[model samples]
Target: MLISMNTCSEISVVDCKETAEKLNNAKRYSTIIIVGRIAIEYIGRAVSYAPEGDRIVLLKPDGSLLVHESSKVEPLNWQPPKSISLFSCIENRLKVKSYRTNPHEELLIDFIKVDFIKICNIVTSKLLIMGKESDIVKLIVLNPSSILNASIVVGTDISTPYGKIDILLKDEKENLIIVEVKNEKAGISAILQLKRYLEYYASRGLSVRGVIVAPSLTDEAMAMIIREGIVYIGIDQLINGIKDIYRDIYSYTKFKT
Candidate 1:
């Protein structure tokens, strides 16, 4: 192995076995990047294979793995954070395998000829995202019961002569549901929109539930929903979800300084 003399981060040239040993110590480095000629194999949820080629591999202390090709901005293959990472020297080559238990999926990266490596611990503030109603609705659509007492999400952005329905759901009691989502506080106009959708369905001789989801409701909006019989859902979960994202950014790798 040829190590750079001036800095600890760069490895000018690498020996596979030696590099694998350093990478095996996850606590020592928050991030590791490898530039090499390698091949990849992923098995578990589905099978995938990438033949030997020059590529970049990134390993996170949280046990995530990302392999990138020469061109794309996104990784060609990735394993989510907090998976189990295992590295070894096999037949004079470095092999990295990361797997998660719940999903029972594994990603294998074989470094045929490692050219360069960057190993260092990193510290930074967690990411904060500005989400819109569409973002929360996406999460809710996948897990309908979490937000609504719905058994299934029938559809989203459903079309009607009135404004498009944000979400369409079927409840446990099998009632069709029409949902309108607001990223901010609910107002009288929001209540009126819900009422119009509900009335439209009622005119068609269909019985459906109307719901408006928002962080807060104005006094008049609350009164209007009560009179119109529209259910109002507070968006506490969406607020908490942002906090959770910030916390989970570096859950596995704690910074000392």
Candidate 2:
């Protein structure tokens, strides 16, 4: 989707201060663009099936542009357009123009209601920080004897062909224990995920036990757990049971020191 200033209609004189303020408030997730007329007059058409849904991507300070459709995940329609530049024509009135080589197609953005100019700061730590899940994994990894009596956490987030196992531990008898941690209720899919990890370990000559750790387990999930011979540890049970063990261990270590 291209916008040419030549065929575009003049809406209003652009306000520099208002434009800066509007651009400053840009977000990371999704952006809305209004094309053709000024922002106020063509709100309905721009937001609807008109040319407003085109996503504008700012290239470098040198002025390269990437325009794509919003409906699909992949931008399969992007062709390398050359000599792209943004010009402030007549006060606040702005225009973007680009050219494609060989066939020589000129792409122009005559009028733009919304355009993202600067990079917006996006916080990514929230996505990686799984509160409940991380807490449970930490407790199990730090103090495995609390969950797997006479066991110790050997590794965590262990990778296999099937998928990654949340926690890996070893029991007193030297058998490998694979744990799958879920913050919410253990569902059928969770049981299946653990089962796949178990199969990967079982194929080897190693002795492995599969376990699911969650707040609760559905009846169907529990049935699968029992059939698959996988252990289910409730979050509440672990907290109540493990805290006492941790306290005793801490006290003992403190006394030794």
Candidate 3:
């Protein structure tokens, strides 16, 4: 359908069901222009007719016509008329709907144009942090036998001589599973950190099975863990463990699939 704004002398083509479906599926658009018509029922009116097309011609306030298609239209050999208003009435309709639906969203979107980079940076940072944390949790959930064994108890913020341990698992018999997580690299200090956790828990009358988890670990750090008798677990291992738990809990083979 073609919607024209009297104030801005601009026109916009409304999308039809078929066109919207195509866009939804492949999410691709070509520059081809198509024109047709459709019947519409107005809220308070009996019936209405509208142009059903992929292209529309917009009349600028200056009396110049610009051809628009599904993508964009370049003004070809057209001189703009000076008397036309710069703003289009069609945009006012969109603004009205936007404000009615979500004024804050509209305001933020409008302001985003001015602070695009800043807004993008903030959004990206938040998404990255959330994604990292989610990945870490998913990893821990993978091995139910490791996480939920009757003897296992996962503890957070356990104090140690070296630093605060993020998570520590202990069996019912008080055998400790020292876990130290670093979202990024398992640094030089990670091995030592786990050692400290093991020692601290052991001193508290708990035997330890040391485990270190990180996105990646340095060769030196890995060697240190092996030398120090620590088991190293990556995020993917944890995710697998979680999947096993979900399978057991729901009694569904689909999870295993």
Could you arrange the candidates by lDDT from highest to lowest? 1, 2, 3
lDDT tens per residue, model 2, 1-257 = 33323322222235745543443233222122333332111111122122434355442322334454545665412235344333344345555444445554445554554443443332334433335887779878777886678898888878798887889999999999998999998899999999888888888878999888898999999999889899888877877777789688777877776
Q: Report, for every candidate in turn, its global Cα lDDT versus the true structure.
A: 0.79, 0.62, 0.46
Question: Which ranges in model 1 have alpha carbons more than 4 Å from their true place?
Answer: 1-8, 12-14, 26-28, 128-257
Model 3 agreement with the true structure over 122-150: per-residue lDDT tens digits: 11124313257445644454443645466
Q: What TM-score, computed on C-alpha atoms, does each candidate reach?
A: 0.46, 0.47, 0.45
Candidate rank order under TM-score: 2, 1, 3
The better candidate by TM-score, 1 or 2, is 2
How many clashes (backbone atoms < 3 Å, residues ≥3 apart in a chain or on different chains) does model 2 have? 5
Scored by lDDT, model 3 comes in at: 0.46
Candidate 2 TM-score over all chains jointly = 0.47
Residue-level lDDT of model 1, residues 1-257, one tens digit each, is: 33334323775445766767767774345688888899999899799999999999888777778898878788999999888888898887888888998889989888888888887666657663437888778866765765554358889998888889999898877778888999888899988888888889889887798888898999999999888788887788655654465465455344421
**Cα error of candidate 1 at position 55, Å:** 0.9
What's the lDDT for residue 130 in model 1?
33
Q: What is the lDDT of candidate 2?
A: 0.62
